[model samples]
Target chain A: MFRERLAQDAARIQKQFDLVLGALSDVDVTQAMSYATQGGKRLRGFLVLESARMHQVDIDRAIWPATGIEALHAYSLVHDDLPCMDDDDLRRGRPTVHMKWDEGTAVLAGDALHTLAFELCTRPEVGTADIRADLALTLAQASGAQGMVLGQALDIAAETAASPLTLSEITRLQAGKTGALIEWSAGAGARLAQADPAPLRQYAQALGLAFQIADDILDVEGDAEKAGKRLQKDARAGKATFVSLLGLDAAKARASELVDEACAALTGYGASAETLKDAARFVISRDS
Target chain B: MFRERLAQDAARIQKQFDLVLGALSDVDVTQAMSYATQGGKRLRGFLVLESARMHQVDIDRAIWPATGIEALHAYSLVHDDLPCMDDDDLRRGRPTVHMKWDEGTAVLAGDALHTLAFELCTRPEVGTADIRADLALTLAQASGAQGMVLGQALDIAAETAASPLTLSEITRLQAGKTGALIEWSAGAGARLAQADPAPLRQYAQALGLAFQIADDILDVEGDAEKAGKRLQKDARAGKATFVSLLGLDAAKARASELVDEACAALTGYGASAETLKDAARFVISRDS
Candidate 1:
């Protein structure tokens, strides 16, 4: 069920991106944006659409935040692929933005996509003005200095640090890096509906950690071709990750436990949240 | 008189920057954000506050977008100074963010500041939700692919082009690169008041063009010590600019004429808009 929904959401989100960016005169940047945003699992968008459905919100309003999160996520990936950062040549099975065009284009395209995220949230079709403002504000909190960027900074800092990060430290870093946006996407529907976001927030917190644990496991044992990007980089750099810190078996067990906890948090929504349950389960099981 | 008001506005705006960024936990990025934002002319910020004042808007609400524009502008400068971009070492007489910190921090700090711009605009203190959404939406329009980023991309493309840009090409580039933000800042007050932004748009279009023409003039004749960053970069690269397209004498005359036109657009505001008139005149006259 979640697989079909995820594919549909991805197509719908891509169409919305086309509608938002198709008219831009900077075809190179917009084209790069489309490429970067394409082929993601659309887990964030699915989380947004499903959460909105659970809240009885319209798909029209939900698509705004859904697409916004994906754009924001895509921008992060583009920047992270820069020479000074991840320095990766391939992403999503193709040349990264910097590799395809140039570093300057990648930077500008990433910045433009980042700006587009907020623009989408502010669309009148999203919801009331207040809800739009809330979406923009929360997005800033999730993606800014204290959130995703902070996590990136910490990750960078670890490269030169005298010692590897402990389990707790890596947890905090992953919470900021991978968890913040997931939590925001999951809670966006409740924000639009002016309902309590607590349950979704709890579910997302566990799901995000589980997602990262699964990623660490993949980096340890998954196929490089299936991943479509660099893997086992933590081992290459002698960096500590969940798999390194917890052992592969322990990491897998922890991920399974977190998925259970994530689903348990959705008890109030009953069967309506089963897709989200599937999503949480899929996060741990996805090969890529 | 305008100098003193501009100085006060810069100081007040800087204080707001401190307030907004101080609460952030990522000290390194926040520090870089502050350093990049400091000691500039604050011309864009002053336009926002002065325009808001012209609309009889309170300073409390006005400062949000005022500071927001400055943050957005600062982010552009930070990224533009990167090694993959302009590769500048100095900005505002201080080492660039990448020089002071590292490329990773510079990238994250710029991203954070860009996010902060929208976050500030969404402040409840700024105005009604509709107004805040308008600010965010317009800001995205002014700064995204078809606006500032588009301009930067063109400028980058110009570096390797077989031929120099024509006068009209440079004009279109400058309009997107510099004119868009100035137009947005100058028209912000009217947006907040739900007034027609037409006159300020006309005024800013002329002012922004005039401002770039003056910058070209400065690159030819101004003191680098006063400018605080590299000057004559266009000439050094053999690139076409306003002064190259038009003779020095003709360019100066054209800028002065633009100042007059920009001032004339404010006839609807009477004496209340004298500061803006002074700003138009100052854009061409200032050394930095």
Candidate 2:
């Protein structure tokens, strides 16, 4: 049942994504953009479309913003793969952009992708000027220095330290680095859905935390091939993880609890909430 | 006299710029924040404030966007100074950030600055959500792949080639690389001023071209000490320049013509246009 739903969602969004990716055709740029975007689970885009559907928001109106979220996600990965940051040579079983090309191209590719994301969201045809502005502001808040950048900064600082990080420290780091984007993804969908924002914010916060915990669990239990990058990279880097702090079983339990909270936040929306519920489940159950 | 007016404009905007830069600092982000933005000519900020003043707009209302433009300018310089781009070792007679820190930190610093620029502009106090959104869209258009990025792309393409680019090609390159930001700086200030955009855009286009020609002339004739970069780097890189394609005297004549055209755009505004007139002269006549 879950597989069917996931496949349906992917088919609906994948064509548009491919088209958008096609627009970036400089060989080096396309290569780097593909490396950053191609292998992802497409979870964020799913949330965008799913949440919009749950509220009966027009899917056509939502596609551009959804793509914008994914593009921003792709750009973040390109920079994260750089030797100065995670320094990982591989992603999704292929060489990272920096490894395949050079750091310079990787930098430019990420910069281009970042700008492209905004341009995509702000297209006059996407929605009202106000909606475009709202989307841009939300995305910028989540992706900018105050949000993802700060998280990455903390992640880097933690990497070089000898001492283990406290639980709160780890939460704070992930909240910015991983959680912020997830929150933005769901929030963007909700905004497009024109749902009441009070409940939407609640749903996003729970969903984001749940997603991060599931990722932590994957880092511990997933196979290297299936995970698409090196397993145990977080541990090797001496970065903190929920599994390290909570133990594997407890981490799994925590993820389950967060997912439950995420689902409960949608109680007011009833049947319309099915896709988001499935998306929450997918975050925990994925191999990668 | 022009220097005195420029100095006054610089002094007025510098205080606001400093305040915006200070607000960016927190305990964790201060080091990178300072490293990315501590010193520069602040030319873009001046344009923002000066343009706003020309229309009798409130300077306070103009400061945020002005600072945002300056931040964008600083971020571009940081990236341009990297090893893969202009490969400069010095910026403003000081060691470039990449030299002062490691390459990775330099990369992150640039990214942070870029994100910070948008964050600053979109702050609630800057303007109405609509105005902020407009500013964000304008800056993104000016700075992103279609604008500065395309120029940089052409620049990288030109770097390794033996062929001399035509004057039109060179103009397109500058239009994207240097001209976009200058144009946006004026446009942004005009937006703050609530000036009629049709005329402002025309003025900005001429000013942007004039600024590039001045830069090209400076590369040929300015002293290395004042330029704070290698005077012959453009020629060595096989990069097209106004001086290279138009010859020294022709480039000088063309630059003057552009400045005159730029100044002429402000004629209808009468005495309110003095600073802009001085700015046009300063662009071509500056030693650095």
Q: What lDDT would each prediction earn against the true structure?
A: 0.91, 0.75
Per-candidate RMSD vs. true structure? 1.3, 2.5
On the 0 to 100 scale, the lDDT of residue A85 in model 2 is 70
Which stretches of model 2 miss by more than 4 angstroms? A1-14, A17-27, A193-195, B1-30, B193-195
Q: What is the lDDT of residue B192 in candidate 2?
A: 65
Tens-digit lDDT track of model 1 for A212-240: 99999999899999999888988999999
What would you estimate as the lDDT of candidate 2? 0.75
Error of 2 at A17 (Å): 4.3
* Residue pairs with clashing backbones, model 1: none
Interface RMSD of each: 1.2, 2.5
Error of 2 at A276 (Å): 1.0
Pick the DockQ winner.
Answer: 1
DockQ of each: 0.78, 0.49
Worst 10 residues of 1 chain B by lDDT: B21-30
Q: What is candidate 1's lDDT per residue for B112-175, written digit by digit as tens?
A: 8999899899988998988998899899989998899989888988888899999999999999
lDDT of 2 by residue, A1-288 (tens): 546765666666667767776765354655566557675677777777777776677878878877778888878888888877778898878888888888777888788778777777777756776777777777877876668877877877776678988889988888888788778877776676455665656777777887788887888788989888888877776667889999899988988888888889889988878777777777788888
